[model samples]
Target: MGMAMTSSPQPPPPPRRRRSRLQSATTISAPSANPKPNPKAKVIPLLSDVGRLQSATPTPTPNGNPSPNPKGKVLPLLSDVGSNPSAIDYYSRVASNLAGAGRLGDFLIAAEGLRAASGDAGFAARINWRLLSRGVVAALREHGLPHVLEFLRDADRIGVHATVMLDADASDAVAAACRQLLDERIMAEFVEAIEALARFFVKGIVDPMDVLKIFVRKRDPDMAIRYARIFPHSQLLLCNTMEAFGKRKELKHALKVFGALKDQLGGINMFACRSIIDICSHCGSSVQARIIFEGLLAEKITPNTHVFNSLMNANAHSMSYNFSVYKHMQEIWCPS
Candidate 1:
């Protein structure tokens, strides 16, 4: 018993070791006396960033007035942005904004800025000429003749000639403008302008024949024929011009045009043959009509009733000639 009691009293249980609350929990780092901020964390605006900021800001009204806002503190306008933007950045942003807004009048004004901006390296080619041309053509269609002429004049100024021809609406506007020019007695200028534009007809975006028709209807058949010769496969226009010559009794010119079509378009369609025969009949050239009829036969082009009638009428002075054409038609129609 004495020995057990001695073992129990041994060391009073070595003073129950204790841990403080601070020892049990995580410790926070103390603040440095001179802390350094992270340099990489700071943001510097880029050219595009500056552009976006400006674009996101409000723009002044067209009349040089600020638009009213009932809400709290109005945002700064684009004009209010400081002069930190580069020329390319500034003009590109302005042109893009104006064009997107469909503000053609404003876009034209801004295009001057874009033209200036194009002087910078790699900027001229960066512009979307297709988009630019579309905007300009839509503007022309909306504003009509005055704006169409304005666009033509400014195309060179704005460096858009290479792109303007790619747009169908632009081509239509040009045709309309040419007609206007002709109506205004500006024939020499119209001719010069159209001749220059005709080089682009191979693009096939605009039909050269449509433009030629404008001149033809304006009584400028010589110019019409000149342009028609440029696109020889434009058979309808060539025939129309030949018919015009026939109506004017210019048989030599009509025959010359018909011959050009025959040479250029690789023989003639029924329409062309009919047109030439009608012209020959009108000019009372039975020999020329007979030659054309023989050529049509050589080409294996079946003669229609109109062709037979034209051939017979061309030689109406000779009953034998008329009877011969009639007999040929009967043989073709009734193979018996």
Candidate 2:
């Protein structure tokens, strides 16, 4: 095999063409001597035609293109797209499609068309509160809290205060959602949202205490009580609310409040004193509350058996320097 091995011959190269001196001296010309300027070329009008057109035509946006009909045209932009068949019919056809697709940024151009058409006259009337609320709700669910809040503020600046508050008509559903979040302890966010709504809907006229009561009725009684304290005028309601606490074995609250009120008044009705004595007897603690009863009597009120019984029941076990006080109490009740 080594003896028969031989190198293969190389193939010949093709001959190169040579140019003459005169031909070499001549230069190549451009594709066209008089090139037509682009028919749709953009010329900077010191004031932007785009800017000028911006006032009238729906400016083509990026997310989705806008329409090009004369009614919705960017005159220069329209000519540009029409000049090239391949270019988007952005001004003519694409704008409507974009708005149809719910691309708000794109549809804003169409909105421009609409705003321009009505000269913003029918805007306030046509874009009603119901529609506005629906839009806001959609924006909130679709975008987020900040977005909705921003819209709410803007609407308020314009006069949508009534509408925003009226949305409480949807409170049942909204409140249910808030409750679930509260239970999960994810309330910070929802609380802010609700607070924003409260600020918008009930800002000046609403009593914070009243609002808290509503929440208490719906969500937290203790919190409601604390908030209720902020409203000094809630005394009447709070007094009546004691029965509710008593039913729940929270009589301490009722007694403490009523007792404090009695003490603060410095003098109360004999019937009122008797009622306190009865409460003390029921709780087996008239002696602990004796100072109040004594103070009432010192003010010329008569102490009854109910009052005497209250003292004995609460003080019987304790050693008293005046065992005579007990004798007097017994005789007072069964005086012979």
Candidate 3:
């Protein structure tokens, strides 16, 4: 011990090195009754950060309200369009523009909106139906019959009438369209299409007789009869239809048409009489042929040689009737 004390007064052990507060806190993990939240831990800002961000944003008005944007445009509502004159004008312009641009679908939509808002007040008059019809007719000429038909149906639904006079080209196109419908066996649509075509006659755009000729050529008996009834004064149509029925051996139809012609024309003409005589000859109806011949005489319609020949031919199988007809023809000719 003496030796140690004499060893440079044995410098007291170096004072224990003191740890800094940071080092002590990091190194120490002591438990507590009320554990406080970690100060150094990351803190996610909830309401405070959101509030700060909102406060930083610039408000349009001093009263914390947003002002209308000068560059933003608002479209008028369809419901309010009825009460708003400007809205009506705006939609009308839109429709006109769309139509002018050849945007048919868009034009239709705009037009429908306007129609619902405007009601029946000059609805049809306000539109250039002629122009619209031209477009549809052009489509029909292009063999777009199905599309045009659907478009017309939709237009009707929206209270838009598409009535247009069909020109020569349009008439031909419509005929072709009808042929297609018939080929497809779409009878209902075919009837409707024909009715639509007939409407052109009402407007004096197409001749009903011409349409009858078309139906005759197409061998559409129903349509021919319909148009014939519509234009009862069409003598040529009636004659042709009767001749067609006779050729097809449709005796019933031929007789029916002949009777109608007689009633409508106030009397049968020489040509019609000849046609009926020929039909009787073909059907071997000697009795009917005799009746028609007598009727022609009673009407003061002089029987021609051709009419007499047809009457004889009708009774050719009956020697007695043939001889009687020949005797009558000789008497009439000799009666000079």
Query: Using lDDT as the measure, which candidate wins?
Result: 3
Instruction: Kindly indicate the candidate among 1 and 3 with the higher TM-score.
Output: 3
Ten contiguous residues minimizing lDDT sum, candidate 3? 47-56
Better of 1 and 3 by lDDT: 3
- Model 1 is weakest, by summed lDDT over 10 consecutive residues, at 72-81
Clash totals in order? 0, 6, 0
The model with the greater lDDT, 1 or 2, is 1
TM-score for all models, in order of appearance: 0.45, 0.35, 0.47
lDDT of each: 0.63, 0.47, 0.65
Best by TM-score: 3
The sequence of per-residue lDDT tens digits that candidate 2 reaches over residues 1-336 is: 568878999888988888876776676443777888776666332211334454454667686887555643233443343344332223323333342343324433433443343343233333334443444455445765556555555545543342344355333334444455555655355456555565544233334544543443444444444434444444544444433443443446546645544554465644445544555545656564576556755776657766655555555566471365667555755789
Local error of candidate 3 at residue 258 (angstroms): 3.3
Query: Higher TM-score: candidate 1 or 2?
Result: 1
Q: Compared to the true structure, candidate 3 yields what TM-score?
A: 0.47
lDDT of 1 by residue, 1-336 (tens): 465544445555567667766765545556788889775573433232434553233557999887764432422333332342454554555565555444555665555544553443334454455566676566666765455455555554565453334456656655676677666766566656555555443344345655665665566656666667655466777887788778877777788778777877786667777788989888878899999898787877788877777887788899987887778778888989
Model 3 lDDT tens row, 21-82: 99999889868879897756753322112224322233379887877665444455545556
Model 3 stretches with alpha carbons more than 4 Å out: 1-59, 63-74, 95-113, 128-143, 165-192, 201-236, 244-253, 259-278, 281-284, 290-336
| Error at 223, model 2, angstroms | 1.8
